[model samples]
Target: MNAHPLAPIPDADVDAFWRDGVICLRGLFDADWIEHMRAAVEDDLAHPGPLAREYATQAGQRFLGDIGAWAVKPGLRKYVEESPAAEIAARMLRSRKVNFLYDQLFVKEPGTAAVTPWHQDGPYWPVQGDQILSIWLALDDVTVQSSGVEYIKGSHRWGREFRPIHFGGDTEAYKMLPGETLPDIDAIRREPGSGGLEIVNWDMKAGDCLLHHSMTVHGAPGNASSTQRRRAYATRWTGDDVVYAPRNGQASITIDKPTIQPGEPIDCAVFPRLWPRPQDSSLA
Candidate 1:
């Protein structure tokens, strides 16, 4: 229920997501939902679940994050199930049926400086196909200088896969997934013209979100600002083409004993169906 008269997402934005692999929406989430998500994040920070990890050092201060929190937090579950995010994902992916993948929480206290390595989400997870994307919702005012998720324009269309770098900077991703790949991002950024790669990011408010493709090249800079704290939640969604492809790669650890196979459609209690909301035109 868009009770706060949010701005309608433009058709152009949907097309942009399909073509460019990333799109940002403004004022899509209402105030109450933002507050609820913020509270939920605070709860998560206090009580991180099994997959939670404080990246780097928590001794003085550091970036704290975790994934698959919908199972642990009731408010987050309600937000994921009842909010407009699923519908928005369906519209962006041009999918009639969508599946809930998982929710990732990222919080950076003021003056925390830890750069997120440039990587794509698809190769890191076991899911297959291009119908999956993540909706990153911000609960605090985010600036490029503070905490911003940047994207490489049209990187999704490149049709190339790369190794995923762990945020902790210890594990070598290329060793896990062996393959010949493009040059390192640090190398690419140094080259002249960078082979048409264009990195972009936007200053976002509490209610703003970016729906980015699974294969899109993205990474966020650390919170360098002295007084700005960044709080955000990223909800991953999948469409009809996504399946339980545990063969090609390691399926998301959040999922346990999946009942499906590589080529089969992924539909289990863990990865619940989200879209095709029942019609309710009646006024109560």
Candidate 2:
């Protein structure tokens, strides 16, 4: 197969993304796209369908929710299935084939004190390997005070599996292994740029995005900023080589009774290929 020669992914950026397992892409989507997605999010919030309960939180509080493609609001269909976002994921994975792992919305309400536990996205996911990628798009400005994402540099290479926790709130019920609590938040704050730990708070505009590998260790503190609302749309994708692997103790949410056995190809519709760069075209 001929490799499509698209615009070169910046060497520095690619190296950082591969080494640390995350890369922040500034102003990737334009204002129009951002507005469109924002509208979709609003619609979902207003009408919130069946899957809405999965994402719903108490009124006047921050929460995390997911609406599967089939259950997504009509306004979000195009963005969920085929959008500039999916195209970017396809390119980043360097795969002619791509799959939709899922779409999630992370909302940090003003004064919300919930913190996301430090964990790798891969452990919770059914797919294995480094084929997975996650795109986090901010719907509103994200600042450090508002509790934006902070990643552990090069933690993807740690190669040790940390316990998976509930995505929405802190809990020890899902801790599959003996895991240590993350170091003091205040200490982490003191050494923001120390020890090769490149902590990033984009304080991003609506269209800015952060792409990270599935194995990258990341977490966000509570939203303390009273001014800005920290809302984000996160989409995950997998490349050609990813396969289903049922964890011994974990329950599967997206799959039914584990159709994908360990070491089996992930051929389910939930994760369908979305894009393939033009092979013979001259777009590059």
TM-score of each: 0.91, 0.81
lDDT at residue 160 of model 1 (Cα atoms): 83
Instruction: Choose the strongest candidate by lDDT.
Output: 1
Candidate 1 structure lDDT: 0.80
The alpha-carbon lDDT assigned to residue 141 of candidate 2 equals 82
Each candidate structure's count of clashing pairs: 0, 1
Model 2 scores a C-alpha lDDT of 0.68
TM-score between model 1 and native: 0.91
Query: Can you write out model 1's per-residue Cα lDDT over 1-284, one digit (the tens) per residue?
Result: 45222666678888999888998888788888998888888888888877786774546677887878788779888887888888888888888798888888898888887877788888777678789999999898998788799899899998788776677776653465744354677677778986568988898998999889998999887788899889898999999889876533343557245676778777777888878764662211
Local error of candidate 2 at residue 167 (angstroms): 3.7
Best candidate (score: TM-score): 1
Compared with the true structure, model 2 gives a TM-score of 0.81
| Cα lDDT computed for each candidate against the true fold | 0.80, 0.68
**For model 2, which pairs clash?**
55-65
